[model samples]
Target: MSLRSTMHIPAVPAFLDSVRLRDIQLPLPAAPDPWHRLGKPQPCTASLKLSYSSAIAAAEKDDVSLSIDYGKLFRRLETDVREMAQHTSSPEHPHHRMVSVEGTRREEMKASAVGQDPRVTAGIVANCGLSLLDETAAGVRRMSHLRQSPRNSFSGSQAPPAPQPADAGPAPITAEYGRCEVWLQLPKALLRAEEGLKYRSVTVWGYNDEAGADALESESRSPVVLEEEFRIEGIRCYCILGVNSHERVEKQAVIISLGFEGPGQLAWGSTVVDTYVALTRAVAEKVDETTFQTVEALATFVARIVTVDFGNERVTVRVEKPSALPFVQRSGVEVTRTQAFFQSHEVAHSTLATRGEARSIEVLVGPASSLTLFRCPKQAALYPLEEPFIVQR
Candidate 1:
């Protein structure tokens, strides 16, 4: 039937509508008793009463218009119910389609999502490890500022300071000097030699001064005045001789002195002597003119000695063979002297007379005539003068 016609059909209850009746007749059963099954047994009333209520109700209420309207409403309701079920169950409905589209779009969005770039974060971590920043947040801010700032602004400032020079001033002085007093013990064999044959005992009195003159000269805007003194005491040997006698021997005694010279030119009071008699002999041989020449030569020699280290200085030397007549059992002599700007502590035979022997010799060096002495014949006579110095052991 057409949908419109189905909607217009007369109403029928669902129970009654589902029931069906056969169109054909059935044969009757043979009677069992003669009393005859009177007329056909009353229709099965019990079945009719239990299962045919809708049909009975329909038969009792016969309003054609109302039935027709009810049938139309029921047909419409059924049609509406069927359509609702179809819509709820179908996979292609608008709601289901919309959900599928949404799910697919969500998956696509996830697949297209961009991963984070780690270059900037990695740079920040490295910078922090190097102590360039306290944390990642601060590092990021700093980088941002740096990117935005002008590059040339930081490059225009002044350069760092330079280091100072080393040789900018005069150096400090360290040289030193002094004088000394010494005693010497001698051997008799050494005293018997020509140079030693004049003394029985010997004494040494000397001074030393080292001014570090080089340093003073370098730093001083003006000239420097330097003075020094020394006192030294040590055991040594000497040869002694009588004032007039030629015989000599060795004796031990304390020697003392007031003036001493460095290895520089000999001063006016430094010398080596053994006897007054020998001193007299040496003096007697000198005429006034010869003595003058000798003195001048001696001065020149001293100057030569002193100037060996410093050219701008003068020195004086003296040799005195003091008489030993009263102090010793025999007669003898002692010698002493000084020098200025001396350069050495050693005494050489060549430093004294070229014809006499020296039992002991001392030298002073520097501005402070520091005194140094030698008692060994080989060392004291290093210059090998014709006269040898008597050095006992």
Candidate 2:
């Protein structure tokens, strides 16, 4: 698909169509206290795409049985993921809480202490004071500072990392807020010098079981599987975002995460710095202006802002409400949408009514400044975007 939304002629045949379901929410069990120790539990957003030419046969013959039924697949996944999330995130699920001082070491110490004379033991105990690290509360709040680098993020070491575990404290150690899984696949032929060729016949798509797994593990494709991605996290904003009576009147704090995929490169004439400034401002503006009844609604709305207004092929949005559940760190939903998605659906939003007469923000035609978004210095240049965005005061 084209990276930017424009009227275009598709070069590929119709039989090569793929069915994709993106950004399916799977709530995870709460993370461990000192949440990164054994495993971190956090809500996860996932995507799945199945590319096969069998769909063409079904379409050509109008036979429903020959092709995939996306609805059935979605419902099954939803049920399974929801059950897993509920089981894992439940407070009473079988999880070892903080280990108290009664392990084998304590038992050994007791045995050794039994043989010692009371006077000598008392004297030794008195001489050396027993300083307890256990008495101090766990600094759960400080975990926010631990994941400053991308390596610490839980989502991907290859693609852009997702948000790590964070909590304000007194919240269970199991609170996991942000993680994303995007398992995407394109043809292996994309790496060749002369690109944009379709080699596969629209009539077939599968392989022998062993050969298929082996082909996936090939050296050239193994590492590069992480798709070209652009992501921004921790966009803190306030809006009405729940079904509760009080939630309807009061604006609550929400952290939104936004990201999109490009076809290896960016749109023509676009720069990473300019895209970031423009998208960040646009997301903030849209988020602040729209009031959503649910986190999922908020996620979808933000996704439309990127895929429609911003003209990106695929975009994902995760919206978290910090105050929703006191026991969990943050609860939210994530969604991924494309330009084609908006084309097929009618999005009726009461929150996005037109404001007063609009005026266009002019592009910078003169000397650039430190705050300029028109161009980035040579060192930071990456990706292409359509037009220049004006970053005002």
lDDT of 1 by residue, 1-393 (tens): 001110111122234321221111211111011122322211110000011112232244452311112233233333422343343345343212111101211112112111111111111111112111112224334644554455634554544333335553221111111111111111111211122111111111111113233432221111010111111111122223222212122222212111233321112111221121232233222211111112333333333333332232333333222334456543222233223424453343244444233343443211223423433222323333222333222
Off by over 4 Å in 2: 1-226, 266-274, 349-393
Question: lDDT for each of the candidates?
Answer: 0.23, 0.39
Give every collision pair in model 2: 30-174, 31-174, 42-176, 270-384, 270-385
Runs off by more than 4 Å, candidate 1 = 1-226, 231-236, 241-243, 246-323, 327-393
Tens digit per residue, CA lDDT, model 2, 307-340? 6777666767888888998899998888887778
Q: Residue 105 in candidate 2 has what lDDT?
A: 10
**Weakest ten-residue segment in model 1 by summed lDDT:** 42-51
Residue 185 error, candidate 2, Å: 24
Among all candidates shown, the one with the greatest lDDT: 2
